[model samples]
Target: MFDWNDIRFFLELCRKGRLTEVAKALKVDHTTVSRRILSLEKQLDAKLFESTTRGYVLTQAGERLLPHAEAMESASATIQDHVGGENRNLTGVVRLGVPEGFGSQFLSKDMPSFQALHPEIELEFVANDRFVSLSKREADLSITLERPRSGRLISKKLTDYSLRLYASRDYLAKHPPIKTVEDLKDHNFISYIDELVPDPQMLYLSEFVASPNVTLKSSSIVFQFQATVAGAGISIMHCFVADEHPDLVCLLPEEIEVNRTFWLNTPEDIHDLARIKAVTQFLTELVDRQKKKLLGVLE
Candidate 1:
């Protein structure tokens, strides 16, 4: 019979794709991870992964076993919750994936309060522009700009936020006159690199300016916001982030306005976990409390 512990290691290795990372996650030595994988392969009588210089790539055999292993893991977690009484205390790691702007400008500030309340629940915050996969367990929960269409996932509309065209006061002073949307075509603009923008919605300039004279391109919204503040160029920025900056001026509030909703997503398998539910509740309450600021109505 194959050991369940070895299967656990196999699942982690498959998810992470690295021996050292799996070892770190499991709090075991890298050598132990290698040994367990090899032992599992011997028992199963099949090579589960292809060892390459790049990293461990799952073989056909590994792909076939992945779903089974994951299902077993889920069942084990449920069993532990009931049998071992892990449900009594909301203790476990919960990884949250959020966009760059919300994670840094907004959520990061409020994390201290959440941590204080649930000190036993370890939290990992992943802030990036790219989508992190919930099916692969990349993150326990994610805040996405667009709702995911596929996967056994549960998503809720977290909140609606507003974005508007902004330019540094110094930049507007030096540039050509900007009385209407037509004048914006000639202005130096800052936006995400066309190729690097993961979602088409990120290209907010396209809504107003047909052909923008992009002076600078960056993947980070924070970087673009800072550049706009430094008088680099006019850029579309979230109101929640840009409103706090005194140097940035919102342009043509009547003509230029964009509204987007953030969706909170969690996989259905572990959605009911006490820790996951707690974080989700916390996020909902937090966003509701700050609704006015997110809608760009407050100072």
Candidate 2:
């Protein structure tokens, strides 16, 4: 007989790679994860992992146990979803990772409604520019700029959004006349730091300016938006966000348009879990409802 609880820890450890990360994800102490892993190994009488300076490396036994444990996880999620009848009372934490602009400007504004409907379901939101790892359980759900290319994950195209050059009303008033993309070279630009850019797709300035005179760089798109709004410099700003701020002026909407799509992604193992399913549905509906805004079809 195996303790399903122990298997839970095992699954987390295999996914996370580090005991500390596993402990954080499972809401347990690192020692507890170590104890559970040891106990499971003792019961099975096999070394499941090789502890090294790098991290835990799964042994043959652990690798063999992985698929079985994953099947059990899927079975458990199916059972819960079926028993819950897709009810709103479904309870558990669902961590969502999203790009800073979407999370801060868009999703956070609408999340209050989700919270009102699903009071029992706790939300852990991570708004970042970096890619959150579903395989590592860093986030249960994620909104990514690009579709995930690998892993046991599921994805859906959320919506397409446009970006264009923007500057503060005051900045444009004080700067030289803008007639073409060539004029952008003389203006102060704001952009993401090259090394800190989480994905290459985020490096959008080169498309407009061959070598921009970037006066400021930030990891958060929200910050860049704010700075641009404060007359700091021009930036390639998301239409959905920049359009809302009356102080910012869109430049060359026809000639400098940049289109990008957001993708919703989740690990296959927990995709059918009641809470996850509920959130995914909510997200799909929300994006659909706001498709006009997302695609810059509205104002």
Candidate 3:
């Protein structure tokens, strides 16, 4: 018979992808994590992971075992919360994946308030430009630019936000005046490297300009914002972020508005968990409170 406790190590390893990280998270040594995994694999007579230079990659057996193990973990948590008389005080780690700009510039400021309300819930923000896989369990929940077409997931349209072309006062002063979209061709522009953009919705430059005088390119929206702030060149930026900086000026807002939606997604299995529900509620309320700001309405 396999030990139920061994599933904890297995899940941790699957999420972290590194023995040292799993060890640190569980307060155990790396060897102990490895030993538990090996023991579990031996008992089942199935290879759970294959060691590689990148770390341990889950084998077919591991993939098959994941959902069952996660169900067990969820059940254990539910029992602990209800039976231990701690249902009122929600406690667990919720890893949220989000786009870098929204996470850092928009949500980061509001996170402390949520933390204050749910003091026991640990929040991990996996803020980056790439798509986080719900199927692979990269995060407990994610805020995606596009609603997923298919997955064993629960998703909703969180909010609709706008982006517009912006340049610093210093940059506009140093270059030609952009009275119309035609004038944009004369100016140097900062934009994403074509190959690196994770989503086509991010290719805002192409929507208006056919041949842009591209000077700077980066995969990071934060870096592009910083560069635009430093007077590098005009670049498309989220209105919520750019509008906060008095130095940044929106150019041709009526002609160049780009609207996009953020979808909140969670694995269907754990969507009803107290911790996940709390964070989802927090996010829903957060976006709702800032609806005007997100839609680029300044009032």
Best by lDDT: 3
Q: In model 1, which residue pairs have backbone atoms overlapping below 3 Å?
A: none
The ten-residue window of minimal lDDT in model 3 covers 79-88
Q: Rank the candidates by lDDT, best first.
A: 3, 1, 2
Tens digits of per-residue lDDT for model 3, 94-113: 89999999999999999789
Estimate the TM-score of every prediction. Answer: 0.92, 0.91, 0.91
Q: For residues 1-299, write the lDDT of model 1, one tens digit per residue.
A: 99888988998888888999999999999999999999999999999999888789899999999888988888877666557764466778899999999999999889889988888888898997677998788999999999999998999999999999999999999999788999998899999989989789989988988988998999999899889999999999999988888898889888999999999999888788777899999999999999988988865
Error at 3, model 2, angstroms: 2.5
Clashing pairs in 3: none
Q: Compute the lDDT of residue 285 as modeled in candidate 1.
A: 97
- For model 2, how big is the CA root-mean-square deviation? 2.2
Superposition error at 207 for model 1 (Å): 1.5
Question: What lDDT would each prediction earn against the true structure?
Answer: 0.90, 0.88, 0.91
Report lDDT (Cα) of residue 228, candidate 2.
97
- TM-score-best of 2 and 3: 3
